[model samples]
Target: MKKILVVCTSGLGTSLAMRLSIERFIRERNLKVKVEHADMGSANFIEADLIIGAKQVISCLSKQNDIETIGLEDIVRRRYIEEQLLNCDTIQTWLKEKEGLR
Candidate 1:
């Protein structure tokens, strides 16, 4: 299963919402995945195959452990959660490409 960690300011509202949306999206497609959430200030407790966060938090996480990050601001808009999930798919593709290159 793919492991994903989502980070946000408080790790409450947006993070929880995104996690649910992503879970549903993957389940519908019968994909195996796990999603975890953490406050941007305290992310060390969780390890992930991918780390996704709001744009404001991306820079802080960029240099941490070589995990791929998907910026939420670039994808979230007009209160739409599906848009963020679409961006997640793009991130997944990028990860696949990187793995292929190796």
Candidate 2:
């Protein structure tokens, strides 16, 4: 399964909430993706195909790692988050590949 990490500065409430939102989206879309949460410091230690967070956080991660990332303007907006997930090319390609497997 493709893995995604939802990151925040402290890895507490905000990250957990974002992870839940992403999980709900994944379940609704029937996507074979694993989602997790981490703090900025811990994120570097975890392995994930993709990382999602506030724009600045993602920017910092992008500079530090080669993983694909999605940066959000509004962290708590479900519609916006879903829209970004739908529009992301990496996610779209993975979805297509999964469809072919089925």
Query: What TM-score should be assigned to candidate 2?
Result: 0.90
Residue pairs in steric clash, candidate 2? none
Q: What is the alpha-carbon lDDT of model 2 when measured against the actual structure?
A: 0.87
TM-score of 1: 0.68
RMSD of each: 5.0, 1.5
Tens-place lDDT digits, model 1, residues 1-90: 578787887888878777776667666645556888888877766778777777777667646676667767643442354556556654
Clashes of each: 0, 0
Off by over 4 Å in 2: 62-65
Candidate 2 per-residue lDDT, tens place, 1-102, comes to: 689999999999989998988999899978889999999999988888888998888777635456778999899999899899889877888889879988
When summed lDDT is taken over every stretch of 10 residues in candidate 1, the lowest stretch is 74-83
For each candidate, what is the lDDT? 0.68, 0.87
